[model samples]
Target: MTDQQTVTYGIDGMTCDHCVMSVDEAFRELPGVTDVRVDLVAGGRSTATVTSTGPLDHDAVDAAIDEAGYTLVAR
Candidate 1:
């Protein structure tokens, strides 16, 4: 077993549970990703905490968020 590493990303345009699920599912599909936790804030930036076996690829994470119809911004 490998130790999990977590990273938080700031996301915009997530205003509901559906949005949270979308983002969660997006990150869940990535290789090495073990878990996803979302802190949703309506009408503003939300935070996504991702746990994986190792450090994740920023570009991949960005693309996944984009595919989920959201934007991942640096915080």
Candidate 2:
């Protein structure tokens, strides 16, 4: 990616460690994703900063996040 671009997602419904694990695992499976971090505090809002090797499609990212049972807030 260009200078390590970071994409943050406002995730919802992340209630515990399991939520963190699931979200982390799902994002890690993506092709260009390099790292994923999630925060389950504040009524289940996670900021996942995906460091990709190249540009990422927001739709695809959103889909992955949604598939993990979380709603992604547009930043």
Candidate 3:
């Protein structure tokens, strides 16, 4: 089986493509992250799907999301 792991995070304050890029960039900076996708739910909660090689560091994930000027919530 592949070692790839995926996790989705609920986020707030992402209103457009620029926000998506910001979050994507922040997540990509994290260790082990292979890919990042953001589902824009403008004016409501959004989802960011993250692909990585192994278990993620939740704190780092949280920080990255925050760095993107968003809030991370339960998905």
Candidate 4:
């Protein structure tokens, strides 16, 4: 079995439960992503923890965040 790894990213513009859901769904679609958790902070930076079978693609993650209408600031 592949070893699972976790990555944390700082998100911008997440202010509610809906924002959490959007970010969660976006990361979940990435290849090998096993789980996603977001700590939503209103009007401030939030965080997303992503678990995957291995390292994920940075561009793909960025695109997913952009598609979800949020910005991935740092990893």
Per-candidate Cα lDDT values, in order, are 0.94, 0.80, 0.91, 0.93
Query: What's model 4's lDDT at 51?
Result: 93
TM-score: model 4 vs. ground truth: 0.95
Q: How big is the RMSD of model 1? A: 1.0
Candidate 3: tens digits of C-alpha lDDT, residues 18-52: 99999999999999899888899999999999999
Clashing pairs in 2: 1-53
lDDT of 4 by residue, 1-75 (tens): 898999899999898999999999999999999989899889999999999999999999999999999999976
Model 4 global lDDT (CA atoms, 0 to 1): 0.93
**Model 4 clashes, total count:** 0
lDDT of model 3, residue 49: 94
Q: For residues 9-68, what per-residue lDDT tens digits would candidate 2 score against the true structure?
A: 788878888888988988888878888877777575667777777778878878888898
For model 1, how does the per-residue alpha-carbon lDDT over 1-75 read when each residue is reduced to its tens digit?
787898999999999999999999999999999889999999999999999999888999999999999999996
Worst ten in a row by lDDT for model 4: 33-42
Candidate 1 residue 29 Cα shift, in angstroms, is 0.4
Q: State the displacement of the C-alpha of residue 57, model 1, in Å, after optimal TM-score superposition.
A: 0.5
C-alpha-based local distance difference test score of model 2:
0.80
Off by over 4 Å in 4: none
Clashing pairs in 3: none
Question: After superposing candidate 2, which stretches have Cα over 4 Å from the reference?
Answer: 1-3
